[model samples]
Target: MSKKFLDDAYNLNSSQETQDLYQDWAASYDDEVAENGYATPRRVAAALWAHLPEPQTPILDYGCGTGLSGLALHETGFRALDGMDPTPKMLEGAQAKGVYRNLKGFDIDDPAPLQNGAYSVIAAIGVIGTGAAPPETFDLLMKALPKSGILAFSFNDHTLDDPAFTSRLTDWVDTGAARILFRESGPHLPRQNLNSDVILLEKA
Candidate 1:
């Protein structure tokens, strides 16, 4: 009944810390998050589906931990899915789900880990939060996309409260780099009373 990792997930200070934490938590990550009623993955999947209904669109689930997000996308009818995570242990869990067409592990510090225009759609659900990916990660994800590509991501209440996180999003839209296609605030983890904003952005 230990919830150490979940409790400290949002307080991570560095990429190393985040990686180390997930390496250990990967095995129980799904069950632990489920107990809290994790909802961002489904919410993000449905929002992306609304904008791009094509079942064959290629999708990159960045920071896809344990394949829950991949499952949601698959259930929503996306046939092509590629998952990438910095933590190999988590990637192993994701691989076991048999949802993704391709899966790989990359160093979180790599300046441009994603291939440009490789995926028409990218998802970063439950990433880019207080103790997860930093604000700059948003720019990296967006830059990897081709013009007209879509990026669907979420910012939990903790991330929303910090302008550093919210500002990165505004900077993109304000600069005409990307346009907000869909944004809705809803449950992230119901049991934790947490809420998150699921957003879809298309490169201009």
Candidate 2:
């Protein structure tokens, strides 16, 4: 990924902006990230597997983004996945992979019930902290998860510097709604010299 692309991702201010950004980049998005050595998707899948290894476990790949994360999940032996993304083009790309049980094109801000709160696991992957998914994305996801539902996600270095993101995570733990199962900083993209922290949370 180019510096401009990375910067644009973090600086987005609205869902429309995020949708437009992905619409423009959807074609090259997968290859671009791969060329940059994107590892977060695989890492996110691995983290989720640690807590919920059952292949039959239902999963919601929130902000799935061209289905790369969903594919990662399938590759790791989790197949029962439903994906949702804000960008139609991106979601289309994901659909072609034929891995998800369902692929819906809707922004996180949209007023729609996701799986009617039935998912055992929700993988946000590279969604939160970045401007791609708004801060409220967390609350929305938590609402969709029943007690004991796990969330797997990641935060790049730029997002880690933002106290708003980190503080909200602490609040999740402090409020006794969730417990941290895994968190560790690791390579994000070697070419970009960036690193991110992978996190796993189990809702209480």
Candidate 3:
């Protein structure tokens, strides 16, 4: 068995460190998270589907580590899915799932890799927060959406406790840039006693 990395997931201090950690953890990510009862992906996918409710609508699963999020989206009836991640090893796992129409890998330092308005609905499930993508990533995804576009994502208990993370969500809503369509807190990794907030935002 591989050494467990989930315990150190939130302690990563840099983008390179984060990428390297996923590279090593990619193979066992699904199994380990499943063992811990990972639930955010399903919850986020359902929330997004409830608002969009269009299976054919194209979705970009940004930071789609290992395609678990993509699988959840597919299970919710979404078919036109594209995924992007910074870790190639993680992308390999995602590719094996065969759910995304396209999967791409990007440089972690590439601040604006996504073409603006390319996806009507972009998901960042488990992408942002303490040890993952930074707060500015929320801005990047929001900027990539066209008017009335949707962004569905999650913030785990660790992230929700940080003002830096929650403030980004509020900044967009408070500034009239986006509107909250759905926000619910529920199980994330039930076995670990973790919880997360599944949030959906429509670009205004």
Candidate 4:
């Protein structure tokens, strides 16, 4: 695969564009991202393990793409994992992992795909940023949660460089809609020498 795949991964303009892009990338998405030494999966899983610790609580792997993040959660001993993605091909890849109890397909631009109070924590690893999910999706996820819901996400160097992402997170914190439980910067993709901040927040 050419580096253009990596370049095109971000830079998306519409829901159709994102669906088409992932559909094409779904088969090799795991290997391609693995080359970058994708670290967010482990980081997000660790954050959840540290804070939540309940192995049986329902967890939704938002933007789960190929079930990579869900697999990580399963490996961390989380059994009630469910995954959601917009691309069916990617969902198929996830299904093959046998990690999630359920997998659904839904566009992020649409309303929250899951029912209210469906999950105790939403793990959004390597989902939003650059050419992918918009920051507005974050608000939607927050709204989908019941009180005390946990939202764990990560922003790579590419995404965090955008001041708006930083600003949006800060605004959510300042407004008292959520409180930051844990935040730390660590390895993201060693090949790119990039780092990301993994954050865990609770709904107020």
lDDT of 1 by residue, 1-204 (tens): 665477799888899999999999998999999999999999999998888899989899999989999999999989899999999999999999999999999998888888798887999999888989989999899999999989999999999999988998999899998999999999999999999999999999
Q: For model 3, what is the error of residue 178's alpha carbon versus the real structure, in angstroms, after optimal superposition?
A: 0.9
Candidate 4 structure lDDT:
0.85
Q: Give the C-alpha miss distance for residue 11 in model 1, angstroms.
A: 1.2
Q: What is the TM-score of each candidate against the true structure?
A: 0.97, 0.92, 0.98, 0.94
* Candidate 2 lDDT by residue in tens digits, 1-204: 343355577778877787788888888788888888999889888887876789989888988889999999999999799998878889889999999998887644676647556786889988887676756677778778888888888988888988878777888899998999999899888788989999998889
Q: What TM-score number comes out for model 3?
A: 0.98
lDDT of each: 0.92, 0.83, 0.94, 0.85
Q: lDDT at 146 for candidate 2?
A: 86
The C-alpha local distance difference test score for the whole of candidate 2 amounts to 0.83
Question: Model 4 over residues 1-204: C-alpha lDDT tens digits?
Answer: 353366687678887888889899888788887988889898889888988788898988999999999999998879999899998999999999999998888765676566877776888898878778877777767777889999999988888998767777888899998999999999988887889999998999
By TM-score, the better pick of 2 and 3 is: 3
Q: Indicate which candidate wins on TM-score.
A: 3
lDDT of 1 at 54: 90
lDDT of 2 at 186: 93
Clashes per candidate, residues 3 or more apart or on different chains: 0, 0, 0, 2
Q: Which ten residues in a row have the lowest lDDT in candidate 4?
A: 1-10
Q: What value does the lDDT take at residue 36 in candidate 4?
A: 84
Cα RMSD, each candidate = 0.9, 2.1, 0.8, 1.6
